[model samples]
Target: MNTSRILRTTNVVLLLMGYQRHWFEKTSHRFRLSLPSVVYIFVLGVVYTACFSQHFDKSSSTLKVLKDISPFLFGLIRVQLALGAKAFAYAIYSSVKSVGAINSLLKALPSRNSQFTQDEASAYLLLTSTFGILFCFAAYIAYEMKFELPPLPDAMLGMALLLPHFILAGSVRLYTVLSWLSRGQLKELKKNAEEELRANLTKDPGNIASAIFTVSTEGLENLKTKLEILEANFCIFAQSLKHSMLFLFAMHANCLLGGFYTLTYYWNTWYVLFEDRKRRIFYAANASIYAFIASDYICLMVVLFMMENERRNFIEAIDLLLAQRKLFSKKLRPIAKDLRGVLKKKCFKFGGPFQPNIIYVSLMVCLQIIIVTLIVTVHYLEDEISLLKEEFSSTDDN
Candidate 1:
């Protein structure tokens, strides 16, 4: 409730928002490369070539190709649409970057007394634009579902499956910016308090106790307010991100196991079919793309987990500062006690059910590898048993 606290909060909010705006701007700039669109076009061309080069009769070839590769094609379309939404969001954010317009918009909001800085206004606008893009994309998918009979259901299902991931991505971005701002504010507050205490002690050494009490009390209050704000606004994002990470972890494991299963089951057939140069090229390209996607998902989850860990560490550092007895006077000790109580009661954490530290991350990686290895071993055993059965039957016939 202090004036300095309000100013600091506002400044941090604005800084966090500005970071989002700059991110969108950079993303928009990158979209100029049109890489996603090019990838989509390239994928489409590959499908077309693969479909036409088939030696089967036209009907059989068409059906066979569609059956075999429709999932990949649909995946490409979904990815392209998501990229298009990103580009659209970037455009919307870029068009509203004028300071006057942003300020006016913020002033028009119901919380006008909050005096949202221009940077905060820009950040809110960018967030709104992003949501707008997501809404439009969802609406378009629903609209297409009303008319398109074949791919509509599949497309809708895919969107539904990916919605959590999209939410996690947005939340991660917002939480990261907010975390950085919080850390910066904490550092600044500590530095300013130290300077104020030094000046007070120099002026009147006898009043050092009062200066310490005042600085410690104010710092505790500021830290509490910041944590409250973070908990209220950003914790949901962290929770959602945690859920998304777990989901991705499960997904990657499934992909690994499924890929091994498919390869084992179809190895002989694929070996014969892929003897053709074009078929081998197609298979390799498709496998590489799938591998890249899976790897990217894993990388994203790792980065998000690491960021969450850093945020938790920052909070712990503040807790450590409060625990320092030398920094507190007798009169200010109760305030520090209260701050510790608050922290104990409402500590911000990244994971639910399991703590997401380095050990957890390493465990997840090892679990996937172990599962994949076990699956491959089982598959090999099955193959050996089948070969042994064939040899026994031939011997009996002889």
Candidate 2:
């Protein structure tokens, strides 16, 4: 999949977006954080403040006035919140990198040339990067069309908005790529561990206690060391992403909530547009905005769910190995003890005790979609439902 090339591209893009430094830059060839990163963030802040400040003016359009009163308040809140979160995360990321944690973690990562085919990985990378970029652009176009801002201001706002959309979309793609690739690596490791265990057990089928002895102590210790390193690296990765992951979760939630409210509030206007074939473009664009939001949210939730599933499966394999600890000699018992310690720890941390199970997260996402759907459906059918009730009453009278 040309991992080095992809990594370089990602580093360049991230630095341009707004970061103190790139996360996975090569040791031999580093990309230094320069003045452009700060300038970009500064420009973004100025653009956001200038745009919103004008919108808040009493003489401005009704749309601007209404934005303050509506759920679009979240839209305003999100920009500021995102900027703050990004800054905080970048600070943390920079500190983590300064201490060499990032480099160590990068080194600990399994080879890209594992069991997952390069062609398949490349396809996924291409698909995700393309979809994220296109979706962001589509959302921007849809927003611009739906709002119908004046030319100069519209162009300026589009420039301001488009950068963040593209940058954040790229960030999301990067996260998903890492998650799935790590999942594949973990899966490969688990498979190898299982095969080794099976082979060891085969040599002593009648005596479970003798299996550990059948495998060379050196081989067992090597596997133990690998797991130890894996656990440490996984934790470092999670720690590095602690703030950023929370920010992403908040962003997805804010978008979904804002989108749902926006759709419901504007349904009547949109329905009118829908009824007019000539104005259907407006309706289609508005719908696409929400579609992009829902799709992004669901895409993230599904990938994380799959990653968690693989993590749990791997943990269970380790647990099975630990279960036969009494059979191991003193040398191997220490390995079992360390494995037990790893079991006690969380694989991924998402800011303190906020770790959510996949089922809970999936259900919450599903519920949001269903609720948004119902809101649109009920509003669309409101007149029909009223007529049906009137007809039933008249028939009863008759």
Strongest candidate by TM-score: 2
Q: Candidates' lDDT values, in order?
A: 0.43, 0.54
Tell me the lDDT of candidate 1: 0.43
- Per residue, candidate 2 scores C-alpha lDDT tens digits across 118-193 of 6445536533544565566566656646656556544444344334443455445545555555555556667776
Cα lDDT tens digits, model 1, 25-113, are 22121112234433543453354334323322344443355447434333434443444334334422432232223222222121223
Against the true structure, candidate 2 reaches a TM-score of: 0.65
TM-score between model 1 and native: 0.48
**Clashing pairs for predicted structure model 2, backbone only:** none
Model 1 RMSD vs true structure? 13.3
Best by lDDT: 2
